[model samples]
Target: MVKTSMSHEDYLEAIVMLGGTTEVPVRSVDVANKLGVSKASVNKAISALKEQALVIQPHYGDITLTDEGYAYGSSVLGRHRMLFDFLTKAVGIPPEVAEEEACQMEHAISDASFEKWEAFVKGLDV
Candidate 1:
């Protein structure tokens, strides 16, 4: 997998969340709205993603994820979901706090470490 910045990962995840995996492409404006950023920011991120061949977009057109992009984005989203669940359900953190923390942790945790942690969590009775 291509190494990408955390910001780029966020953009890819946003695209997937916005249905970039489907035949229907995702609009830059929607991505901006989802990420609480400007259209210019989305444009910049899209440009970077295109450079990486992770997404396809025409001039001023909607965005669609390539297969690689979808897989990477889905992995990030999955990590976020798992971390959020652990924080909220297992640790009893507030939903809002867990959401924020999970977002940060998802980018920092190594895949190997995450896998081990997941195994540990699964082994728990509760």
Candidate 2:
């Protein structure tokens, strides 16, 4: 459990997604560009996350999530998936828009709410 939730996890997950194709290292600039944040902001967040042991960095290393960070990020990612599914299937939303909205919606979803939604989505025939 991190003291910072949602926004912090959002930035980390964004970084991981951008770093998906490359295992080299995730630069603050890369995260900034992906999330439309400034490099300085990313750097600050990274530093704070590192202090919390949610991220790791060496002398000149890229960002790597600690187990705690990864677990939290993965849960957020799963919530994004559920939102994407419901928006597209139940609401007849366009994939592009659904993905965009899901990214934002994932952060605020409650655990209980998400669970019920997941069950509802799962029970759907299509």
Candidate with the greatest lDDT versus the true structure? 1
The residue pairs found clashing in candidate 2 are none
Q: Which runs of model 1 end up more than 4 angstroms from their true locations?
A: none
Per-model TM against the reference: 0.95, 0.82
Which digits, one per residue and each the tens of the lDDT, describe model 1 over residues 1-126? 997999999999988888788366899999999999999999999999999988999998999888889999999998898888899989999999999999999999999999998888778632
The alpha-carbon lDDT assigned to residue 82 of candidate 2 equals: 80
Tens digits of per-residue lDDT, candidate 2, 1-126, equal 665666787776876676532233577778889889887888888888888887787754678778777766667777888899889989999999999899888877778888988888889953
Q: For residue 14, what is the lDDT in candidate 2? A: 77
How far is each candidate from the true structure, as Cα RMSD in Å?
A: 1.3, 2.7
Report residue 55 deviation for candidate 1 (angstroms): 0.6
lDDT of candidate 1 at residue 98, scale 0 to 100: 98
Worst 10 residues of 2 by lDDT: 16-25
Look at candidate 1 and tell me the lDDT of residue 9.
97
lDDT of each: 0.91, 0.77
